[model samples]
Every structure is written in structure tokens, then in C-alpha cells.
Target: MECKFLLDDFHVFAVDTIGHPGKSAEVCLSPNNYDYGIWVSDIITALGYDKMLCFGGSFGGGILSKTMCVSPEKIEKAVLLVPAGIKNAPAYKLLNMLFPMIMYWITKKETWLLKCILPMAISEKNIASDTYETAKCSIDHVKIKAGMPSDVNPEDMKNYKASTLVMAAEKDCLFPADLVLPQAKKIIADCTVYLITERGHMHYLTEAEKRMIVDFLHDN
Candidate 1:
């Protein structure tokens, strides 16, 4: 994704999650332990940031949640975008995501499988051709391990002190807004929640949603 919009305003430090596809190390940290938090903290320290505003989406959101629970002092604020770890994904959602992938692997027909999955997984219907191509390439080449991140414990959420903004997609079958929003409000102390009615798990934020996020990051 092109983040020039965000980079134009703020100095963004983006890192590939370890074990995920990217130039980062191939070590996958266990979600059940503090290793993810520690690894992130080490990166922040190395970057010379005493405290930074952190934003994460999907699996990265799970890592951010873990960091908040274990090392809240390292983060000044946080934004979670359709984050995982709030609740386990429903079986149908998993099947919806996995079936197309399996078909693509067996058939080697990336375009057809992506076309089938996009409507079910992503919110945007009119995606750019380049974006679609990039996604297709990544999925075809990337080596990702199977397993969802463990759910964030309620006590951990309660212990996090940083101001947090959790944006949940209403059509997110993976992490339904109905299930995530209420639990987030009940746990995080200074939390703001937005249920994006037009979005799904793979969100495509509207102009207004983008403004809301920018305002929150700057104002809070």
C-alpha cells in the first residue's frame, strides 16, 4: 500500500513483522509469550524513539495489543485497524478466506481466485489493477505460517494506559465489529471505537474515515 499520505505528514517507521514475508528475519515469535513485545521494543529502542505513536492492522494489530499489555510505556498512542486477537474468527469466515487460497494453490490461477475472494474478504469493490497485481504476487510468493494470533486477555487490555483507537469494520467476518467493539470499550481505559459500516476485514477507508484517523493521531 502507498503510505505517502501518512508519510507526508508524520515520520512513519514501518517494520515487517518477523516471520511474515519481507526482508525481516524469519523468526516467528509466539503470541502466547512476551517475545513479540520484546522484539518490537528492541526495534523502537534501536530507532531512538523514546515513545512513538503506533498503528497496526490485522495481524500487526495483535502484536500491538501484546506490546501494549507488556510494554505500554514504549507507546504514546495506538491505532488498531480491524485487529485480530480480540476474538477467534468464526469457522465460516476462515473457510471463506482459506478455500479460495487453496484453490489458487492447486490451480495456479491467481486472478480467478483473487476475484472470488475479494468480495468476501475486502471492503472495496473497485480496486486498482496495480494493487490487485501486487497482492496476487505477494500471496503467490509469500510463505506464511498457519494459525491465528491468540486472543488478548481482558486483564492485559485493562492494564494498557495509552490512548487507543480501535477501528472495526462492520462487515469484517474475521473479527466482527459486534464482538470486538464492546469488548474493547469494556477493557481499555482511554479508548475510542469506530465501527466502519462500509468496510470489511481488509478495509478501504473513506475520505472521512481517513480524516478521523489523522485527527485522532494529531489531537490525542
Candidate 2:
């Protein structure tokens, strides 16, 4: 069902985020500033949409945080899946990944790539083939992101009133549910959080969970 969401009656619109792949400026916007939110706001206005539902995961969720901070009124509802920008674990926690990543960069070996990703996914079983391949290709090609978006000031989110859904994983090395859920509850006014028990960052959703997300997003 998720596969058919691209051009179905729900009219889901996917935009290539600025500075990522596809048609966007070569410049990477600063996550700490309001630039990302402004860019998103402009896109919404340019498309002549008064309000829209939004979905984002991981790095993209951080960008959505910026949008909520900048243009909360423009969003009808939001689903943040394994989102960032709430409380990202410090970079030191990720030192285990550095060696394998460098080795992969140096050797361009798929084995090394797997090693590079293992820490995030926690186990090979959690790493879907498509997820692995996409990460492999993206890493080989896309320029590395500079940093995660900074924690949004509570005051910045004071005006955000859109109903929001957050799905966070318990063992996410980068944005653990312990960190993300509490803050999400604290900052988002009308928020619902679902913890993916025992799962890490790369865990896949069950079909029922996938259907739940689709249903939520489809509810205009």
C-alpha cells in the first residue's frame, strides 16, 4: 500500500529537499537558522496550497521541525517517523562507525559499507535490502550532510498547534525514543507518540503500522 501512495487518490506530493538529490540549489542551508523553514514556506506558497499534511523521517524530520518553528499555521497535520532535531545523541556515540565508513570510502567495498551501517541498524536483520542499497548509493554519491538541525527553542514552537504524530524507535543510536519522545511531548501541543519497542533506527514498520501511517496521512 505504501508503494502505491506515490500517485494515488491521496495526492501525496514529494519534494526533493533542497541540497539533496534532484532539482535544488547546490547550496546546503544551515540547520541552525530559519532558512530551511523559510524555503519550505516559500514552496508551500508557490504551489498555492493553503495548508497540507506532512510526513518526514530521520533527517527529513529535522527539517520539518524547522517548518513547524517557522510556519506552523501552514501545516494541517504532521507525521514524524524516527525524527531528529529533538535530542540527537552526541557525535562521540558514533565513533564506532568512523573506521568502517572511512574504509568503505577508501575501498568502495559493499562489505565495508555494511560495516559502516551496522551500528545504526543494530543488526543486519533490520537492514532491508533497499534501505542498504539506497544508503550505499547515497553515500557513494551525495555530499555528506554537515550537521543535524539544532534543537528548536520552545519559544520558537510556541505557535505550533498542528496535530502531530511521532513514531520513535527505542534503540535509535542517533535519536533515541528516550530523548525524542519526552521533548516531542513537551513541545508539540497536540501530539501523539508511538514507541517502536526494541527497535533501532533502521527497523522496518509492520504492514499494520504502515497501514496506520497511510490512514493517518490520508485523513484530511
Count of residue pairs whose backbone atoms collide, per candidate: 0, 0
Query: What local lDDT does model 2 show for residue 200?
Result: 86
Candidate 2 off by > 4 Å: 1-9, 218-220
What's the TM-score of each model vs. the native?
A: 0.89, 0.91
Instruction: Give one digit per residue, the lDDT tens place, for model 2 in 38-137.
Output: 8888888998998888887887888888899999999899988888777788889888778898899999988988988888788999888778877887
Off by over 4 Å in 1: 1-3, 119-131
lDDT of 1 at 205: 76
In terms of lDDT, which candidate is strongest? 2
Encode model 1's per-residue lDDT on 1-220: one tens digit a residue.
3234577568898998888766888888887666777788888899998889998877788788878877889989888888877774665656666777777888888665675557545634646566677567767787756665667788876667888999888877777889888878887888999998866666467778787778888984
